[model samples]
Target: TGVSKGAMLSHKNVVSNVLQASGAYSPTLDDGAEFVVTALPLYHIFALTVNCLLFLHKGSKNLLITNPRDIPAFVGELRKYPFTVLTG
Candidate 1:
């Protein structure tokens, strides 16, 4: 409901869910891959946790987006690499 660490905490929860979920719809993180988060790193939790921690565990690169709100800019940033995963 606010802009702070709570957002990061929530993102952490999402990462945990993805990692722990046994559902068939879930996709587990690969041992090695690159993840690019298009969501604002400072605006929400997904980038904070998943891009930071989970990728770290898998020895993946986390492309942190400082400003994800700008659509064109985001696309431009995305075109720079072949990202294995993009977390919103």
Candidate 2:
């Protein structure tokens, strides 16, 4: 996976990607009303920008999964919440 060196992104770059993704996905989220299940580690750009930042920007709840490898526990946790969006 060591394919390239780390690249820096400005605040505008991050926000712009989030906005573009939101438009493309058209997530039907309500402020503080929807739940988002995020199985990927937040350290990753995809999870950091989309699942955590973008959803929070729209005021949706974020359910962080510390260990997605535990399938049973993951499924159990998923069932516990009426998640509106799921990203891994």
TM-score of each: 0.59, 0.83
lDDT of 2 by residue, 19-49 (tens): 8877866656566777899999998999999
> Which digits, one per residue and each the tens of the lDDT, describe model 1 over residues 29-74?
5666556454655434555445665566567776777777787988
Best lDDT goes to which candidate? 2
| Candidate achieving the largest TM-score | 2
Clashes of each: 0, 0
Q: How close is candidate 2 to the true structure, as a TM-score?
A: 0.83
- Against the unseen true structure, what C-alpha lDDT does each candidate score? 0.61, 0.86
RMSD of each: 4.9, 1.9
* Model 1 per-residue lDDT at 16: 68
Q: Evaluate model 2: give its lDDT.
A: 0.86
